[model samples]
Target chain A: MKILIGISSKKYSEPTLDVGMRIASILKSSTTILDVGGKINEFSYKDVSIANELMESWDLDRPGVEVLEWAYNYLIREKYIEKNLNEIGFSKNLLVDKGNGRSEVFLKGVAVKNLSLILRNGDIIEELRDEVQSFEYDLTIIGGSGKRSMAHDLIQYIDSSIFVVNNFNLKQKYRILLAVDDSPGTSKVVKFGVRVAQAFNIEVDLITISKDGDFSEKFRIASSRAEKMMRRSGVTAKVKFSEGELVNTLVDIAGDNHIIIMGTSSQSALTKFFLGSKPLDVMESCNCPMLIVK
Target chain B: MFGFSERSLTTILFWVTRKKWLILSFLLSISFFYFPTPDGLSSEGHRTLIIVLVALSLIVSETIPLPAVAILILIMEVVLGVDTPDGVASSFMSDAVFFIMGSLMLAVSIVHQGLDKRLALLVINITGNKTWRIVMGFVTISALLSSFIGEHTVGAMMLPVALALIRNAGLDTGKATKLSSVLLFSIAYGCAIGSIGTPSGGGRNAIMIGYLAEFGMAEISYLDWIKMTYPMLILEIPIVSLILWKTFTPSQKTMDSSVRKLKVQVAKTGKLNANQLMAIGIFILVFLGWIFFSPIFGLGIVALSGVFLYLSFGLINWKEINRNTNWGVILLFGSAISLGIQMKETGAALWVAGQTLTYLEIIFQDVEIVRWFVSVVVTGLLTNLLSSAATVAVLGPIVLDMGGNPVITGFMTSIASAFAYLTVVASPTCMIIHSTGLITSADYFKAGWKLFIISVILLLIISLFYWPLLSL
Candidate 1:
């Protein structure tokens, strides 16, 4: 397995990138560090000058030279550190952007390299529509800071996998709750849930809510699908289904569960995720932690 | 459909007719004179009044979208032989709307660039997490921004900040309802204070300056306005903060001691992006221009300059800037201003004022004492009920008719205008806050009454004692 960890040329990105590289090394996977340049366009140099002039005219506090120097050093460290990692018989590469140029860093060991697109906000999603469009990662290992909204966004985007290192000292076996719907995504969801169940020696309970009614037939189909996924993955699991309001039903079913895991299409954020008539209804009603997989 | 029985409809109609009896009577009298007789309302001069009122209601009720309403109003004007379509259209796109559009673009850019959040967070950090501290923080920031920017912009800016804090803290959304209500009203209060700090803070402030010039009192510069108002704001901050804290917060003192966590979160917030920084710069420049450059360049010019600069720089596009402006509020402002003009021009306001004074004399039997007391109470309460501009317009000429000095009239009117201190829906601040969907109108009414009482008393103190001392 391999991963591509992108880093910005800022001091803040240093600690996060270091942690990412360490996790990749532990997982025995090749890690590529992508160094994103500050120059977003050809006129970036002139843009900086004009930015300073405008700031001064407005009597704003100007960006100091020290910060600029730190940015440059951080970019340099990306290449040097990757070389050091490569020396340890680990597959490591540094991808740097020449000023105002575009580039890509591929996860080479993956079966499909074109699963996701890395573009800025306004980039046309349609341009990459044909790409099977999975998460950028098969699984992402993150440190204990679960508070960052951006990290939450990245996890949802990939819908790959997430491993949250919690505050508890123990390498605890996580209790998993899988909320399933009749979609292709459910197959991947069940497989992932079963792998987790087997690995942690925890039982898996699959609950499918019949939002459209007539749950008996749909439940049988979902149960068979879960069994088939488990059989293929060489794991045994239990499945059941019930019917009610979506959010209320899910929350009630997830009582005392360690986490509520579900997936959304890429580009969901905190606000859009919580928007509804009773937007906070589920969060207020739910007792256990929610791990929303986008 | 939710079944509304005929019996229920009849009951509702009975109640509505009973409550609206006075308005019904007035409407009946007008219709009886104008419609059936054709001799009742003189069509000679009242044509302008009739044309403007009908046009205004259509625009404000927004039964149709603004452009459609504007077109309809223009068409109706031509059909009614009131004016040409071109003249009506030109009137619809008034200078006030243009000024409002320019200001709205500036506000929207500030929001888009996320500068408003940064400024808000800076205030929150400085004030700490104590309930009183939070109130003080909101008041200080609102007052400062309202003074420099417009009150409406300050209200617009702080609302999102209050919501973001509530959501990020994982507190109950109910907490947001009251706190946001208070914050919005604070913004309105700040606007009131800030307007007095500068001539361009509001239309009323400019009118007050013009009145001062007419009286040859002083050339009240920006600094002079600030000098006069800042002391009052400083004195009132503690009182307002206390009232708000008492009203919204729980009685128990369970302080949020995770100060370090808040600090870390603040640190983690990414630095201002280039666009955001540019917007802040433009806002500050425009604000400074309003304060110091008023003698050379007018406020509208400086404001439009900032708007144009941001547009030319690609900080915001034409669509973004255009969409940022609220034409509804602008139209409302024009309508209010036009009503004020008509009230004075028609001799109706003065006649009504004379009748009110006569009634007051019959009740109190002392014209001077009754007049002064009536002036204080009526202006104060009306300020809370209506938009500050509308409140001032109604009260300004009334006080003038009572033979009070111009400065005293200006002082009392300005004080009343600031009385939106109590509720979230009373001012621009309240309107912005209410729009967040955090604070409902009901929430403001329930919890806001206590704060309203405090504000009313404070206004009384200022109007009776503070103004007399200052003006003397």
Candidate 2:
């Protein structure tokens, strides 16, 4: 089996890449590491100013390199420590594209004046679109740092099938909770999550949270629709419904669950306050690994 | 149990607060007929309360049409004895309303001519496929059209195209919505900056111009307005584009070489869009007329000429033209303007202005500085909260009455007038964008706060240096 792991060049990249490469080796699957960065022409003075500030704060020597170099170093160091995957079984090649590609050496090689160039949103999207369209990986692993802000909001806006990585010990048995919403995007998530559940032979429970009173009608209707989706995916999932408050219901359902998968949709600032912030609140409270699929 | 009980109580409380306007209106009607407020409380406070309650009542009714809601507010104001019948009737014809109506009509003509699309396409094409470049292109183009044509029209023209591109890219609908939302916000923000570029971009600009007309020496011609505004558009758009792109780029790579290649490929598809080209020519001609010819000729007459030419040339049919014009918006403009005029006529705005200075004297001490501070902060926040035109309509007379310096007031109003970046519903362009499922109300508020902060800094710079030096 081929599994592709994608990580950003920031703080969480090393641990995520190490963990991912280790798991790929144990499974004896071919692993590919993709590091995302601003293209050479894509950087800008504004971006350099921001990047330099962050780099200075992090005590990193290379402040003006492509974003991919940070992730590449993590992957290389982890490979040296193990000598297990890179040696006998698993193959490692630094995948770099003309657009969305990144490498530690090349990133470190960049100068401050050159950092002002940055790629377009469409280019970044196109790079990912081409990479995903070409690759036939069974699963695409994503390394997400929990720092919440406008940056996370931006990432969520560009890619929807994201898996936020967090540290938690695996149990003998896994309890997976999928919080379904009314959006059509939920259908893709249900189909994807079911496949993962079946692969692990884990029991999957589908849940929907409705607001109290009249608005609950939308949730009740959505819950029935979600049930049909789960059944169609060939998963005999248990369906649950609740009302009262989003945070309370989410926290209660999260209890004892191995992993909780929730869908975050694109919302206006007002609705995001009402909708998107719940997952962040849940992430803070729940010890269980929570995955927010945007 | 506690959580459940507390949740139920809170839900009940929310429901009550949401429905309070209806409850308050009912109680007020009873008090007016049955109990009545004491004569001591019968002054402007209760009348203002009634107006506020009545407006809230209109907003609360989902089943009622907005026009019907406005009618209800009018009726309640009359019945509740807030305004005399003559006063109420006359309140519908405020200067703000006239300015907004005339400006929107001109904007619709531009829209009908297909000018907005042509300009938008030109910008996107020039930017190539570079992500930041495309964003800058979209922002700049949208800003130019919106500033000259009308912000809402720019949003209407660009949103569909942006959405179509995302869909064509074979991207996720949710992600597409996010990017589209950012694009929409940028369009709105850009239009806002652009509106200040010309006296006719928005009603408020015209209102400020009208107020300055009385000053004789306080001159701000169309070309001069453009000169002042274009620099602001240039300054903010790149930063907005960078911030938007940096904040929204996905975690997993979705963009590839094909996407960049696709941008080049998309240009080939641009050939068949001739209506888009005609639209561009008509838009530029009208824009030129507005900037250059209108000052020598009459603005309304020149604007109507463009409308006639577009119609006669079959650039837009009557049906397309009518639907494109937002009559509801026209009514809102009229109603707000009338209210503003009434306030001016009643010397209410002057009274408010006097009270405002008294407070400013205590805080600011220096009258000239207070005047500058007042013009920047009040105009900025009010225009951001309300419609820019409405802010001008209501506040224009008051600013004029301040009698310190017409140039200072004019520059302040113009600068503050462009500061509608706080909420999605604050401006017509915002509403147009918010309605398009591309951007959510929360998305605007989230990014808008930052933009608002930047705008404040920009306003401070303008008031502190740009105005004092430029006006002199």
Off by over 4 Å in 2: A1-294, B1-19, B22-99, B102-121, B168-170, B176-184, B211-220, B249-281, B292-301, B366-374, B432-442
TM-scores, all models, native as reference:
0.50, 0.53
lDDT of 1 at B88: 50
Distance from true location, Cα of B373 in model 1, Å: 5.6
Candidate 2 per-residue lDDT over residues A171-272, each given as its tens digit: 345577888777766766676566556545567778876685344566667667767766776667888776758767777777755567776544443344
Instruction: TM-score for candidate 2, please give it.
Output: 0.53
Q: What is the C-alpha RMSD of each candidate to the true structure, in Å?
A: 15.0, 16.6
Q: What is the lDDT of residue A122 in candidate 1?
A: 12
- Tens digits of per-residue lDDT for model 1 on B1-472? 1365533443343344333533443364356336531222234224434434444344323233344433444454456544555655544443334455566567666555645547656877787776557667777777767766667666655654554444445554333455455554555455555554454455555544443443354355566566556655666666666666666664323226433444555466678877777777887787787678754554456667888888888887878656446555555444444443444444444555676787888888987665555555676566555556545644565565565565655555665566565444356555544433345556655545665566556655665666666554
Question: Whose TM-score is greatest here?
Answer: 2
- In model 1, the fraction of reference contacts reproduced equals 0.00
Residue runs of model 1 more than 4 Å from their true location after superposition:
A1-294, B1-29, B32-99, B174-197, B203-221, B251-262, B295-297, B364-376, B383-385, B393-402, B421-424, B435-442, B445-447, B450-457, B460-472
**By TM-score, how accurate is candidate 1?**
0.50
Q: What are the lDDT figures for the candidates, one per model?
A: 0.50, 0.56
